[model samples]
Target: MHDMAQAGLTKYVAEFVAAATPQDLPDDVIALGKKSILDGIGLALSGSVAQSGDLVRRHLDELGLMPGAATVIGAGRKVAPRFAAFANGVGIHADDYDDTQLAVASDRVYGLLTHPTAPALPAALAVGELVGASGREVMLAYHLGVEVECKIAEAIAPRHYQTGFHATATCGTFAAASAAASLLRFDAKTTARALSIAGSQSAGLRENFGTMTKPFHAGRASESGVAAAQFAAHGWTATDKILEAPRGFFQAAGGGYDENAIRGRLGAPWTFADPGISIKPHPSGSLTHPGMTEMARLIRENDIKSADVKRVRVGTNSNMPNALIHHNPHDELQAKFSMEFCMAILLLDGKAGLGEFTDATTQRADVKAMIDKVDFVIDEKAEKAGYHKMTTIIDVTLNDGRVIHGEADFGKGSPANPMSYEEVADKFRDNAAHARLGRSAADEVVALVRDLERQPSLERLMSLVAKAG
Candidate 1:
């Protein structure tokens, strides 16, 4: 056999996405997929109404587009499927509260995996709606997208993230394309072209993490995916071997990649099922969840008042300090990427939920004091444990000479400690309520996704989430 690494990798991946069917998905995969789709929908609703939400809910003219057949979640209007994908993707990632992929590679930083749902689901929803496809079609398309994206993420050079590329936007474009291509019913050759085209469009930067531009990356990736598929359907030209070309996607973008990560790995275990996905319980960078959980635990168990605490020390692997860039954040967006702010908010509020991450909360004197009290550091032990694990150590000092210690190796909502479907539904309810969605409609959306395979079309589901409920 020819070397799989240096030849036909693009066609190989494209064939998998183009041919995978619902029969390949087991009961549990569908169950977890529905949960993730539900989470993405809920987050998109809340994201549609944030203070910076106007960035998405704008006139089509401002977006340089006209109306089409696809729904923009919560926007009460239809737009081109690509544009719908763009807007809804922005909403899903706006709060950084969507589902995150988990990589098995030791060099990959914990919790920094691409926010898979943010890009994949929007593409599936947009194109699935565009084609009047069944719910199973959409579900299968989304799973295929996530699987391709996660496998690609696993194969790429670790320095891709270390050198500041946001994997969500970079790898996610491929996810979006795969999802869209699946829904569009493109053949393997056409899908290969789409994947190649998506590689050219892939782009995002870590420097944009704390601003609206961050979510915009996910939006653009989703949009680019939709556009790439459409372009290929129209016979757009591109190298079909983009992923394996001598100077192609992996080489140009990430320097190199591990071919073994892709060979026989696409659906061998279903990345969504094997390594699994994470539904963020908090609306911040997932890297902070472990510490946030520990902080919440400390306060809950000890009934420790913030005023009683003299200082807080949070330690993690060295990579975290670099990625959680906002050392002393002053806004909600910045606070999401700030370890200090997340810990402070959890300490002050006893839980870092939606209402607690407001800019007003960040600027509060007490919150500011708590921020100063947090000593965010790089732990030698955590560093030694390897970057693949998100290990965090916490030490709380009370003014009364009491010290509390907590360590978290895995986040509460991770595969190791998964939230049940019921729990995910609860989060969906809170997000829908945050977006002003009616309880009755929100309940129906949950039921619809829960029974995804039985549904004939996305008409009801899109109608519920796409309109201003």
Candidate 2:
């Protein structure tokens, strides 16, 4: 049974690798790819100046690899595909504020901070340009990469996640490899071998949370994936069945998986179509965003001053601790994982933006006082739906005895309640604005991404990212 499963994974990996390309990809897929690219670049540029981002750039510089194929969005330097992928991946995750895949159940089931921006974008861009793949081809590879990453997360999630593995980092290597392989038009055999290499190389530790190393996991995974595919292209081999064999990815890392989850919904039932994916409104943890938005809305609708609120109690699920790791985060990155900090800031300021996580914000005595008053209540029911349905029920007990209860069922940017195109564009522009790209540059990136399939080449897209900050 294990042998057959390995053979099956190898076969499918090969097929996906061989047939995957942007040339014939659907328009929606292309649009999604471009959107992801724009978002990644925006995030990367902003993160480039972040303390962690700068550190990664320094490390990459020390590696002394040949400068080549692709650009690392913020750094404005070109390097080998692997190093580029690594550095770019770190940029995307630096803020701890990228995309996520919510689990169906359990805090033990780690909800993946799944698709960060730079990893897939750089890998696809490098491979596509190197192979002379059109702009459309790059988009296809990206969409395919995201799809692969999300599916793998779903397959091993809750179980693998419970075991304390970062699904994005652990599984992302294969996802990136698959995307790069698709762009390179590798044979199925090579694709399978790439996946095999990725599986073995996959790693991420939960202990790394709230540290710079967490982002390193993302960058390294992407670099490894790109390297894996490139190595396979040269006839390097890996174990045939990386996902399904008794000793494969699923069986080894995945504590006890639903075997059906691995291959059940290959194409017909897609992760992209259901629960869809969240486009971040703020760069903080996705689990906390909804509550923050709702609290901010409540405070605004009632014109509640920050001083009026005596105490704020936020009710969520058991898994929230993962999202809100710090009751008092030492820095912006730590604050991003703190639920109390998120809620307090939302009510105090009524807006959660990029600057919300800064040291100045964290040091604000008012914000600290509010954060101190905030307490978390875990509801088991909310835990079952995974992090997706994090019901943030906030009861503000005022000094004047006005008890207001505000509950948010769906997080902002969730498919149940999504951020609009204008909002996403606005977010992209805001981040890009810091880089001084101007309104025209931001608009051009959005417009080009919106109609990516029609573009002759991704040169314009790449050019925008290569902008010096």
TM-score winner among the candidates?
1
How high is the lDDT of residue 67 in model 2? 72
lDDT of each: 0.88, 0.73
**Candidate 1 lDDT tens digits, 1-469:** 2355468889889999988888999888898898999999998899889755675665455877677889988888889999899988899998888988888887776667688999999999999989999989999999999998898888888888889899999999999999999998999999999999999999999999778898999999999999999999999999989887767888878888898999778999997788899988898888888888788888899999988999989999988887699988878878888999998888778777778888888889988888899999999988887777779999999999999999998777899879888899999999999889999999999999899898899999989987655
Candidate 2 whole-model C-alpha lDDT, 0 to 1? 0.73
* Candidate 1 global TM-score: 0.94
Model 2 residue 60 CA deviation in Å: 3.0
- lDDT for predicted candidate 1 compared with the true structure: 0.88
lDDT tens per residue, model 2, 1-469: 4444335754664576577644555544444445556677777777777787778878877887777777777677777778778877887777766666545434433335476354566677667656767766777777667766766776664667665787778878877887788887877777888888888899998888778888888888888889999898888867877777778887788754555555645443445455466667787877787787788778878888878888888878776775577898767877778888888887777777887778789898888888888888786655655554667788889889998888777777776776666677788888877666668777888888777667777667767777645
